[model samples]
Target: MANKKVHTSALLEKAGIPPPESISSSVVNEIQQFRKVQPTSKELVDGILNGNVTALSRAITLIESTNATHVEKANEVINACLPYANKSVRIGITGVPGVGKSTFIEAFGKYLTGLGKKVAVLAVDPSSTISHGSILGDKTRMEELVKDKNAYIRPSASGETLGGVARKTRETITLCEAAGFDTIIIETVGVGQSETAVHSMVDFFLLLKISGAGDELQGIKRGIMEMADAIVINKADGDNIKKANLAKTEFNRALHLFPAKKSGWIPTVSTCSAITKEGIEEVWKTILKFLEVTKENNYFFEKRKVQNLFWMMETINEQLKLNFYNDPEIQKLLDSTKKAVTTDEISPFAAAQLLLKKHFKK
Candidate 1:
């Protein structure tokens, strides 16, 4: 037994180790300095106005947070930044899945930055319903723009918002504007109905299309085409250039059939090759012309006022629905009400009325 103990000691010595008698002083110091201090609303506002990207990112995170505790502070930050907002040219871009949206955006954004414009791109990615997660891949796709000092790219999850945008997208735009971005581009998940949501918040709506895609307009909805301020047929390089021109002609003809827009500016159609960076300048010129005409006719400010009113009403409606659904009594009743409806024990309308009454009474 003594020899065995001696052998174990020898092995321990060869293994080269001993327990620490005390924690190192540097480790102790690190532990003492680890407390995180949250920035106040004023600080966040100041940083955003000063064009601090870190502050801008934190402010956006606060705005997007679902926590009730962050609501007051987020509102304070937004209110503080409101005076600096609304100066940027907001544009919305939408297209079907395979239309090379990221490629086009990178090229277009680089062009804007080249013209000494500070550009912000807000790309919304669709979330998986089951996992409630999204693959925010805009940064990966927009490699060149990601490195541009004058460009900022943010990818947000759609989070069950039916319109292919994040719920806080408008607020994000405001923050970007406050951060001195001269141009703001909202990129939506390439799905139908998202176009309407994008159209409501942006001064100009651009629809990106490609050629040799089935019926040329197969997947696009008529309402979306009507909403577009401009439609650009992308991939107009090399062999596909002819096909793109043909698509542009057909689109222009289709657009003429629609009634005149309230803005009094005729919608334009153009073809561009995002890969070769051709015709981008023409597209930007078209946008500038639309802005000039709209501002002259007083439609620019008028549209913004109407949109603000619409958003206010939308917020109220959303809050009311949230309050109704989040009530404990309503949640308990909803489970049974669904079964009752399925079993023919109660009509859907009657169940809804019951739930509403309970919600209001409580």
Candidate 2:
């Protein structure tokens, strides 16, 4: 009578009934059939060069993959597409949350496509810091533009600072340009470091503004205002028009306070209603004028060259950090090292040196 044997399996069922495999088998077959054909790097390159959006999307998905196995294939695709890139006009757009960026972009993209410009939009959706999940809803918001044969919209989740917003962005743009998009619109998740990241990747930067929302410049970051090539006051139709105009004037004055841009292009403030499509055309005109001036002064090409250099350096930094963290030995020590620093067992600097020393000892 010392002890009795306990049977946990009896708490449920003696033999669990398996879910119907017959139903799932057909679905699995269909999925396998769909995934059966993954095009080669040369095929993807040829398709992208011929303006194939399917190939372009697949290539971008590969670039975004976190799996190390996909890296080589993604790089091959990017290298193949590079020669056709750097030819498109890169525009970076940013605004605060609830600033109507999606509507404005839809209208602006439609206007661009109407003028026979092949447009590609890389829209970054906000991701949660805790869960790190992103909502890619730009396609739903941009119904008309999504349907246009000449326009392509690819929505990515902003890992905020995990290098998700910046990594592979250049490659995505290159792939889009290779797919013959004359205009590349990079839409940031919101008004933050994402704007700064996107600003570095594009030739022109646009900051979208809204009116009747406290002081016109209250929440605006000075760095963003400075980076903006243009500030567009959105939702300018009807009763909001007057307020929008007033905000535009304030912004124009604020823009003047900053030092002149190196490209010699004065940033302009304009108003537009995405629903009414008013002033959308003018926004394009402003971009065109910016391009004209930058190109004439050779600033555009020079900026591209500088951006290439920045990206090269950024890639090296990211790769080195990734390699360091991904090293088996570092992975083993990272948690304990952090605990040591937090618990006063080791100073932060000393802890970092310890980790680095251990990592580089090879």
The number of the candidate with the highest TM-score is 2
Structure candidate 2, residue pairs in collision:
none
lDDT of 1 by residue, 1-362 (tens): 35554334443543467767597989877756742557899999999999999899989999998666787799899999999999999999999998989999999999999999999999999999899999999999999999999999999998978776788898999999999999999999994864578787999999999988878665589889988999999999999999999999899888889999999999999999999999999999999999999999999999999999988888788778878887999888898999999999999999899999999996
In the range 323-348, model 2's lDDT, one tens digit per residue, is 89889999999999899999999999
Model 2: worst 10 consecutive residues (lDDT sum)? 158-167
